[model samples]
Target chain A: MLEVSNLSVNYRGIRALDNISLTLSPRELVGLIGPNGAGKSTLIKAILGLVSFQGKVQFRGKPLRRQRQRVAYVPQRSQIDWDYPVTAWNVVMMALTPSIGWLREPDHRVKQAVSAALDRVDMLPLRHRQIGQLSGGQQQRVFLARALAQQADLFLMDEPFTGIDQKTEAIMLEVFADLKRKGKTLLVCSHEWGQALSRYDRLLLINRQLLANDRPQVVMTMENLHRAYGQSLQTTMGGNAMGFSFC
Target chain B: MLSPLLSPLAYEFIRNALIAGILVGILCPVVGTYLIVQRMTLLGNVIAHAVLPGLAIAHFLTIDILWGAFVSGLLSSFATNWIRAQTRIKVDAAMALTLASFFALGVILITRLESRLDLDAFLFGDILSVTVKDVWQTALITGVILLLVKLFYKELLFYTFDPLGAQAMGLPIQVINVGLMAAITLTIILGMKTVGVILVTSLIVGPAITAYLLVKELHQMMALGGLIGALSSVIGLYLSYFLDLPSGPAIALTVFGFFLLGLLLRPVCNLNRENSVGKKLGKKYRSQKSEVSQELEPDA
Candidate 1:
């Protein structure tokens, strides 16, 4: 479980996140959605303590900062250098570094975990392939496998759906469902629109501040959309008769 | 052929120079692999040139120049990061400014002091004149750096690959970064005497990149780069002895030569084509959203 209270972040004196607060329970899949530059990513970074923030974030009744090892973060694909000369296996093996300790090689047990993680994401066949050679979907799967290998309680993923293929999406949804079943919590940042937004158990909509925190049907109402998207929604709607199509 | 090459070991200075050169060759590429991956090659050059002021100050204070150079090298990298963080200037511009200013100060101090330090030799290196002490020092530094790298290999790999992820995992990212900087600075110091500051980046980046073109994994790249670096030094020293050329330039040129060879052999190695394919796939995925758009379409 995670609890955030009165969280605020300022970048260059401009409020990126303001007086935000939310809580997540185990076995929950939460989608964080907003327009571009809506500080969706900032909220995640703030919770992870990657950025300076004014707030208290607690994980299972303790400060979140002290419980970092229980969290696994999968950053956006753009943040990584695909040109980096590492195999898919190498990327997954990184999750075991802390447990294996420094100066020690990954033993049979560690390798089995990495292999099993890769296999879970359907990437075991390409484990020896350099990451750069993998497709966008494959790349995302490799990272997903890495997150799985971390065996963490909380998952914070940034844009895991972006640029991925349909198969990857299905695989991810299955994995998310499985993770939820296993009582793990996930906070995923997404820019997806339409019916795809319905996949989450709950939605947290924001534009520099918490706009709505409820079921998708409640959060995706016209009034809430107008408030968060401002004039952009009108332009995006483009005089559609049926209002904005769910797709 | 073997005799011609083996004959150079008859002299002690040549032996010392070869040992020192091989050590520097092995060390620079290993550390430089990290720089290349991080796209911080310019930082290596900045640190290399920044040591001049330290060298001058150490000379003036009658202290060991290596200590001064090491401190100065680390300071320049820190200063670069500090400037980038505190100001609007980007990292490249900050590095260029730091490199030019520190180098200029070193030149000025060296001139002002009119010290007995051979400016030309210091700038260009005099490997043939390396003493036993130099060889011993190089070996010691190489051993220590390699040991540290071995001990922290997994942490460094994770940090370099995904810094934010590693940080979130509570890996002490800053300490890891500082440790890497220290290793790089010490590597530059090791090469300063063999390749000199001016050509040190070649020793640092050349073989690593050469191996990068051929290898698929980080450890493989380091191992192959180390082999390439050692070979380059040995061959470069032989060329210097046989043809009477400057050792630093000879070694630097040899590194370039090996890089060219790697480039030519990349096709045969079957790595370059895969990279290009990956690029093509990336571009196609970016330009066309048809697959995603179709899947997202609501039921008719």
Candidate 2:
């Protein structure tokens, strides 16, 4: 459902990603694994078209803007400031903003969509609670509910399991399994290989470029694992002739 | 509306001053709400101080100080944006650069204007000499600014709360940011009359921040900030009347006092909530997790 080719990103004359190419098939559950500053987020942001990048990112064989309606992004929890008084409903309702779907006062369909999404993630009980009042796991699930409410065909989730309890992790895996069964595609970036490799059908190991993109059983070989997390590799965000892509 | 608060001499001045204070109060919170959320309260201080030279230069040139304040305030706001966009220097550093350089120039200009013109009245607002024309100016400028905020609140909230989401949604994030900067500039400019340039930012920031720490919701914060800001202005003015004190400083201090009281009140509530929620969730999560972890550990 998503294809990226020769992507490069430069921040202040330093290359964060260098000629990275990856792809996900329809309804595929793909895991992206990397160390800190491995261009995992850069790839996600570049795909979202939030920043400038080079190369190509196509979803459903169209540019990002044309196919943006079909894509959903669940950012890492640390990136948000939860102190701002917002409820789960507010967060989930963003799935339908500024469209024919925009509801000044939520209608039946909007409420149904939000509630169903929350129910899918096992968080219907927390629907009325302020997002700040939720636990870490539930907060991540809340964003997933929002993504699900968008009814998007593709989900790009970055580090959804960080600081979450085992129940949340189990819930996340169940959602992924369900998404796969329902013909929806997902690209999840994670650091926990033992759990992720066991769950996802494929894994894409990224460090500036496509280190390996294949079945997790094959790509996550001992050699690849050592190279990915071995002996403290120098990971500079802006480095050599590696970046400068726009898609 | 007739009130016992003013004599004929006192009425005209108080009327003008009250209009100015109320206008400043209303406009300050409109922008101050955003600033408080963005942690840009110090940025307001920088802009307030930076406009002094603008007012001083106008005084020296025998022109209107309001235009001078507007031009300088906008310049500072522009500079704040430029500095943030250009370099890795933190926002505070950029603010310090603008504040020191601009205010020092204002100090020199005011000294020069002092010899050639009556500048002390503008320095510390001689609000008691306010004319009907001044009241009209306050009403017109503040009215336009507040109208802009009312019209653009949704767009502003989108960017202020979710910049990444707004950009993804294809909103002009830069334009909205610039619009907010403009609102903040107009607020600081008009606020200078009631509180003077030196303490204008304190008036802008004090009550808004107090509400920020005390309130959890965005709409509540805005409402509380406006109510507190207007209250402080009226009460401070009254205290200055009875105590025979400097009105601007007295009001600023009162706002600061309210902020301190609100700050002290916060921890008590937070600590109580934290204790109860932690105890409740801790037991439930632990029992649930142990049961699940056992189920997962079977293959080993």
Fnat of each prediction? 0.70, 0.16
Instruction: State TM-scores per candidate.
Output: 0.93, 0.83
lDDT of 1 at B4: 75
Q: Give the per-residue Cα lDDT of candidate 2 at B272.
A: 72
Please report, in order, the local distance difference test score of every candidate based on alpha carbons: 0.89, 0.74
- The parts of candidate 2 lying over 4 Å away from their true place are A66-69, A100-112, A122-124, A233-247, B1-10, B53-68, B105-123, B264-300
- Which candidate number would show the highest DockQ if scored against the true structure? 1
Model 2 residue A89 CA deviation (Å) reads: 2.8
Top candidate (TM-score): 1
Residue-level lDDT tens digits of model 1 in A1-247: 8999999999878899999999999999999998889999899999999999998999999999997878989998888999999999999998878889867889999999999999898776567678887788889999999999989999999999999887889999999999999999999999777678879999999999999999887888899988999999876556452533442
Q: Tell me how candidate 2 scores on lDDT.
A: 0.74
CAPRI quality level assigned to candidate 1 from its DockQ score = acceptable
Please write out the lDDT profile of model 2 over residues A139-222, one tens digit for every residue.
Answer: 888888978988888898888878888787888888888888889999988866443465777888987777888877677565
For model 1, what is the alpha-carbon lDDT of residue B44? Answer: 92
